[model samples]
Target: MNKAIKVLAGLLVAQLLVILALQTNKPGTTQVAAQPLISVNLNTVDTLRIDDSDGGQVTLRKEGDRWQITNYGNQPADQNKVAELLQKLSDIEVRWPVASSAAAAERFEVAEGSAQKTLTFQTGDRVIDSLFMGTSPSYRRIHVRANGSDDIYQVELAQHDIPANPESWMDKTVLEFEGDILSVNAGDIAVSRDTNGDETSWKLAGSATDSTDPTLINTWVKRFNSLVVSALVPAQEVEPIIVQNPALTAHLSSDKGDADYAFYTANEKYYVKRFGSSALYEIASYQAKPIVEIEAKKFMLNTSDAEPPQ
Candidate 1:
């Protein structure tokens, strides 16, 4: 009986040990992650050129204290986008080396693929690093190949997050003169400041002032503040495709200068041509709808406020 009890105790001890061993060896519990695929001093990289196999090449240059998107023109590049790209390039380390042979690179999409984009990092004229990036192998991973070598590696990153196109890097704020927009004549509807001072606000002008509803002018101002384009119309295509007469025109005057945004409609989408940019900007529908069809009664001063808030 005592021998039987001893054997049962031995079996229970073995079962406990097995459970402990299984728990210790579980995935991610005892593993160290792999090292980075590529390493570089991000500060040393002053200029970045991304030549996409898809189409246009984007060139970014750090000028003075700001980064300039210098393809079609030298305007400020979106800093958030530029900063994220640099950080990813500096931090990406290899998941595993996929291929060493040049022929093997095509299978991994690091070479001879239409989707491949080459990122060239430079300090002054000296090349810091040049790498070819391909499509994602899986979620949160990208395939890469270094210059002057055939070694390809799959690294952790979303391939689609980085935009290789030149126009995508541009600051989209093409027209931001809403504060300076003294008056606008959209078809027959017009809005303007009734008086000239800091305390003065917008009201219906010419013939729209039938009532005292402030909602109309307030809604127009709200939309005007956020007026920006989907993308910069490319430089080469600017002159040929642009149109003069717009469906709506907003004549704006600022302390700096006089600027205007003329809105044109094609196939139901609203496009705007500003004074400075040769490129026609597609107007966001949320902003365009209110101004295009806003009624005159909307500019009225509130009855409660007009009565002098008792």
Candidate 2:
């Protein structure tokens, strides 16, 4: 019995040792403390270019203090989007390298000339950092390999996050108004605002005071403040469309200045051009409907449409 007890105790010790070893990371384990994939000084980066497998590319450059999409006619870039991308790239950390061999890079589709996407940061002509992104392992994790490095890592960046399309980087809300719009005129339809004591009122042309729906006019003014276009029309298509008669023209008087917007419809797409802007934008039909269909009579309420007194 004493011998049997001793043997049982030895077996228990062996089992405990195995459990401890299994729970602890072994020597030569691939797991490592998280470290930044690329060290980039964002302030020195003035240009960013992205190339895709389909041979499409986009370049964004910093001009003065603002960012512009250089390939897309120097259109102002959405600053927030640009900043977010730079921040994400700077913050990506590598915990474990999936592979470090040249063959593995090609197999993962992160090698040069075979990568699904490549992004480069530059200061003038000098390249700051370049990275290749390829097949995603999961929804938000993609295989990435830095330029001149065979080590490939899986990072939390999807292909759609870094679009190679110039339009995706454009400032879609560039035409939105910044200040209070005091008045608006579109052909025979006119709307203006007035303030008396603590009361504010709106006037619609051809409609008596207090006869028009103030809510409708207020909504229209709000739309002007929050207008966002779908995308800018190509430069080559601008002259042809502008030469044709516009379907509607509206004048907006604001604290900033008076500006005119001409709306056109061609190829079943709605387009709007701010009189002073060189870029023409394509607008959705739903967004253009309120502005283009505005009429003085629409704002005026008929006697039967009035609500009974409380």
Best by lDDT: 2
Single out the weakest 10-residue window by summed lDDT for candidate 2: 301-310
Work out the TM-score per prediction. Answer: 0.69, 0.88
Error of 2 at 193 (Å): 0.7
**Compared to the true structure, candidate 1 yields what TM-score?**
0.69
Writing each residue's lDDT as its tens digit, candidate 2 over 81-200 gives 999998898898887788999899999999999999999989998998899999999999999999988889999998998999988999989888767778888877788886331114
Task: Kindly list the per-residue Cα lDDT of model 1 for residues 170-258, writing each as its tens digit.
Answer: 77775666454556556666666643633246666664444544444655655655677666655665554454456677765544556
lDDT of 1: 0.68
- List the candidate 2 regions with Cα displacement exceeding 4 Å: 1-31, 195-200, 303-310
**Once model 1 is optimally superposed onto the true structure by TM-score, how far is the C-alpha of residue 168 displaced, in angstroms?**
2.7
Q: Which candidate achieves the best TM-score against the true structure? A: 2
Which clashing pairs does model 2 show? none
